[model samples]
Target: MKKCCVLIPYYNAGDTLLSAINSIDYDYLHPDVIIVDDGSQITKAADVLKEYIGPLNIILLEMDSNKGIEHALNYGLSLHGRDYELVARLDCGDLCKNNRFSKQVKFLDENPDCYLVGSWVDFTDMDGRKLYTVEHPSDFESIKKLMFINTTFTHPTVIFRSNILDSVGFYPTDTPAAEDYAYFFKIIKKHKASNIKESLVNCTIDPHGISTIKRKRQIKSRILVIAHNFSINKYAVYGIIRSALLLYTPRGFTVFLKTFFNPNR
Candidate 1:
C-alpha cells in the first residue's frame, strides 16, 4: 500500500481533539497521524492524546507560541519524507468518515494524472449526528460557481499529491481567513485540477468556531481572491458585481426565498 499521513493542526481544541483522533479507524488504513500543536493553551489536550500515543505513530510538533494554521501545516509538512505519496488533512475539531483515507487513496492510485482530489461531505453537529449534506460539483464550470462562494470543496475532505505542494508551495500565510480558498484559486484556476464525484467525508461544524465569528475577515480575504484571479477591468468588474449580487446577498426574505426555490442553492 502507498503511504499516507493524516496531518492535523491543533490549537485550543482539547474539547473535541480526542474524538477526532478516535474516529479514525487506524486498523484499516494505518497512516501516520501527525498532530501539529499550534501553541494550544489547553494543557488537557496533551494528556488526552497521550493515551493513544503508543498504539499509533503519533508524531507531535509543538510550537512555543500560537502561530496560525498555515505555520502548523508547514511544520507538519516539514516532518515528512519524500516517500509518502499522499498528505491528508483534518482539522482539530473535525472527524473523518471511516473509509476516508481508503477511498481517496484508491482514487488517486487509479487516476495518476490527477493532482488533488476532494469528496462531498455531510455536515454534522458537535455530537456527531448528521445535520445536512454538502454536495460537491462534478466539473470545472460548477466548481467556478464557487469562486466568490466556497460551496464546492470542504477543506478537511481534500487529499492531494505531495508534489503539488512542492510546485505551488504551502497554504498562504498572508490571507488567514480564506487561505484555503486562495490556495485553491492558485492551484485550480491558475493551474489545472480535478475532483472525484464521491461523498467520502463528514465535516463537523462547531456553531461558535472562529470561522463563523470572523465573517468580515473571511469576506475580506475572498475579495483579495477575486482581485488576484480576475482582472480589475470593466468586463471583470461587471462579472464580479453580477456574481456578488447573486451569491453574496444578505439573508432576507428575497435571498432565502431564491435559495430555497433554486435547485442548485
Candidate 2:
C-alpha cells in the first residue's frame, strides 16, 4: 500500500487539539501524524501535547513565536514528511472518520489523473452537533466550473499528492486567511482535483476561527486569487464583480448571506 502522512498545524487550540488527535483511528491508515505548534498563546495546547499517548507515530514541531495559520501550514508542508506519496490535512479541532485516509488514498490510487481529492464534509457546532453536510462536485470539469464562485475543496479534509506541492509551491505566506483558497486556485489550474460524494470529515465551526473572524480579509484575498488565476471569461468576470460587491457590504450581512445561501459551507 502507498504511504501517507497527516499534517496538522495548531495555535492555541486548548484541549481540542488533543481531542482531535484522539479522534483519529490511526490504526487503519498507519500514517505518521505530524502536529506543529505555531507559537500557541496558551499553555493548555502545549501541555496537552506533552501528555498525548497514542499508537500513532506522532511528531511534534514547535515554532519560537506565534505565527498565523498560513505560516504554520507552510512550515508543516515544508517538513521531510513529503517523502510519503500523499499528504493529508486536518485542522486542530476537526474529526476524521476512521476510513477517511484509507478512502482518500484509494481514490487517488484509482484516479491517477487527480492530484487532489476532498470528501464531502459534515459541519458541526462547537458542541459537535451536526449543522449540515457539504457536497461538492466529484468530477474535475464541474469542480473547475465552481472554482470561480468559491473554494470547492475543504482545506482540512483534503488529501493531495506530494509531487504537486513542488510544482504549485507552498501556501502563500502573504495571503494569510485565504491561503488555502489561493493555493487551491494555483493547483487546480495545473492538476485535476475532485471531491468524494461521501462525508469523511467532521469540521467544527468555531466562531473564533480565522475564517470567521477575518472573513472580509479572506474574501478580499480570494478576489485577488481569482483575478490573477482566472482568464477573462464569464465566470471570472462574475466572480470578480460579486466579490468586489461583497467588499462594501457589512461583514455581518455578508456572513448572513453566506449562512442563508450555503450554510453547510
What is candidate 2's CA lDDT for residue 80?
A: 50
lDDT of each: 0.69, 0.82
lDDT (tens digit, per residue) of candidate 2 on 1-265: 2488888888878778877787776766788887888897676356887778887878788988988888887787787546688888888889988488778888888999999999998877789977667787898888887789878999888988988877888888767688988888888889999988889899887889877778789888889888777886787888888888877776556545545677555
Candidate 2 colliding pairs: none
Residue-level lDDT of model 1, residues 140-173, one tens digit each, is 6667655545535678888888777767888888
10 residues in a row with least lDDT, candidate 2: 251-260
**What is the lDDT, from 0 to 100, of the residue 231 in candidate 2?**
81
Q: Indicate the TM-score of model 1.
A: 0.82
Task: State which candidate has the highest lDDT.
Answer: 2
Q: Where is the poorest 10-residue window by lDDT in model 1?
A: 247-256
lDDT of 2 at 98: 46
TM-score of each: 0.82, 0.91
Clashing residue pairs in all predictions, respectively, total 0, 0
RMSD of 2: 2.4
Check candidate 1 and list the clashing pairs. none
